[model samples]
Target: MPARVFVALMVTDSGALTAAELAQTLRVSPAAVSGAVRYLTRLHLVIREREPGSRRDIFRVRDEAWQDALANRDALLAQYSGSFAEGVSVVGRETPAGRRLTEAMEFFEFLRKELDGLMDRWRAHRDAPRPDGPPA
Candidate 1:
């Protein structure tokens, strides 16, 4: 499936769509939709849920899913930063490699901080209600 089609399905307000529906909307084959759904599921970006009283599965984005993805990213950055910081220590700060390692670690650290902040904001916005809606 194309990225745009995948995105369209995921971003829908209903939170779920069938492969057939997605294929129709995207003007693509069911095989393409299936492929995209499989890929998205592998990435943990989309979930498949069986509908009640039916075998047909719907693809949906989980609530707090983006927050979880952000957390995973933060974990990766933190791990990389820790390892690179240690490398910087071993290389000696006065050397070019050491300086480069330090810079890389610093960048990852900063990115981790940014991801943390972004996750917080995402949660806040997600939990907040629209002006016309009830309390979140």
Candidate 2:
């Protein structure tokens, strides 16, 4: 697990590193690092590359990886929204069941709005310039 932590930190910085280098930095055996790398790779979170002059494999986190992951999450919410819409229709607008479904739909609708707001804030933050001096 320490190796995985090291791998995460390593990739977070420059997005690429070799297994041997990771092992040395983490003070673990090459086998251990290799195992962790293999696991991360299998999860599709990491990709492997080979240098032209070396046999060591470099592991990297795919560009826009989190974007794809979040898209998958939003897709699920959209699917649920469709199902909840059906619930609202089936229960009819005047009944208690209909009211409950409407509430559920409203809740998810609010969630979707909040997610949009969050993404807006995230983009704003990402585009904002960093401070030049030390923090207070």
**Cα TM-score per model:** 0.71, 0.55
Ten residues in sequence with the least summed lDDT for candidate 2: 1-10
- lDDT for position 93 in model 2: 64
**Which parts of model 1 have CA positions greater than 4 angstroms off?**
10-13, 86-90, 121-136
- Residue by residue across 1-136, what tens digits does model 2's lDDT show? 5347435645557878777777777778888877887776655566789966988678777665555445446656777777888988887967998888788877877777788777777767766776974322
Q: Identify the runs in model 2 with alpha carbons over 4 angstroms from their true place.
A: 1-59, 133-136
Error of 1 at 41 (Å): 2.5
TM for candidate 1 is 0.71
For candidate 1, the C-alpha RMSD (Å) to the true structure equals 3.1
Candidate 1 local lDDT, 1-136, one digit each (tens): 5476557766788978888889888888999888888887766778899988999998887666666766878778989999998998898987999999999999999998888788778778877988989655
Cα displacement (angstroms), candidate 2, residue 28, comes to 14
